[model samples]
Target: MAFRPAQYAALLLGALTLSACARSPAENPQERSVIQNEDPFVAAMDEATNAAAAADRSARKTPSKPQQSDAPRVDTTAPKLSPAELRQRILRLTAGLQSAADTEAERVSRFLGVSFTPELMSIREGESIGDLEQVGSYRVSVSRIDRTAPGKHVRISFGPAGFSTGRPSICTFELAEFADALRSQGYDAGEVHLPHREQWGFVRYVSASDLTFYVSAELYRANDGTRSGKLCLADVTADAVKGRQ
Candidate 1:
């Protein structure tokens, strides 16, 4: 798994993807032959926003009794949290160390009764470490404190699990509403790295100050016609600001 931006389909994580030296299959043991032999992490992200259906198959088999614990839990994906609240939560999830940082990730882990592996899992290429856990509705992939560059960063991505069958726990977020929420909180309008459809019509990638979110054009069209969608993939990294507009 060579750590490079061109390798990934989208605008790869600014410093996380391409900064590291070339890597090997040993570095990505969990790697699987996916669409276009594309990186599973990236593919997982692209597929997150997709509402299309998959081939009918047998359901996934999970442990009967998984990580059971009496811990307070919260699903940040749920639309319940105000975008402003979710912003703070994104900060909380990536705040400390691994599971020890244990704010949102721990809540998700505890709620699903699935604990992160003791050993760090290589995610989104390079050695940007984190955990991989799957439960009933969603697949959870998160990066540990990103030490590759200087910043408080966490890359989190969630997609509907293969076994999922329209689970209510899945967060169904409308892009416009969520974006507006962040904007109201003083976040910028967003910098488009890759715009789909037309010029600023819809964006595949957008960054605001220290925050960046990637989505498809279907969420909001050129005429500002918004659609019903949820945030399937998101990379939340809090880094230094290059001054403000």
Candidate 2:
């Protein structure tokens, strides 16, 4: 009933060939990429890579905020200065000396360090300049019509407070101290009375040669409610008292 040796050997050879043919393409290394595309592990990795690429593209397309400049901001608006402080700054900056040169342009420029243009056609009263020049927030004029034993009477006047863009008022009594300040600086300054308008006027420096300084202005109101005037700081050469001679 048993098979012969030759027959058994032939059966074994056939079985081996069938077993080799039965193996799937997935089991072969050359066909592994085809299988990997369908594998859950490979599919997850591809999905992660695509998601990362999409996020990168979206980030690139989104707009970013603009950067600000590092430069400092400048304030061109003028500031109001107290009368006393204004006087001090002017005197200190010029060292209480003003140039008396005939070159009016150079004189003003040296005093203020700012350029100015005067209306030469406006000069009046024999060397008294009625021309108004803008010095920041105030108007300025120079005069030397009166010459005295001390020298030429140089008068620099400043117009009122509306120059700095505010309604700043001043008490008339405060000017007395400023007059005293001039006297302290070796100026023959004195207060003069003007009853009709409540004017507290002062004449400073009989001989400054010629002084240049900014005069701050303040609005002063009278009791009548109808009268208002500007209180100002002026640098001048005093004229001789009338009737004294």
TM-score of each: 0.33, 0.34
- Model 2 / residue 132 / CA error / Å: 16
Write one digit per residue (lDDT tens) for candidate 2, span 1-245. Answer: 22133432332334335335432346666566666676777556657878999999998999976768665533322234444444554444224333334224345334433333433444321222222223233223333332322222223334344423432343222455565665465444223332232222222222344332212222243133234443444432222221111
Over all chains combined, what TM-score does candidate 1 have? 0.33
lDDT of each: 0.33, 0.37
Off by over 4 Å in 2: 1-85, 89-105, 122-136, 143-173, 198-245
Q: lDDT winner among the candidates?
A: 2
Instruction: Please give the lDDT score for candidate 2.
Output: 0.37
Q: Highest TM-score, which number?
A: 2
**Total clashing pairs for each candidate:** 0, 0
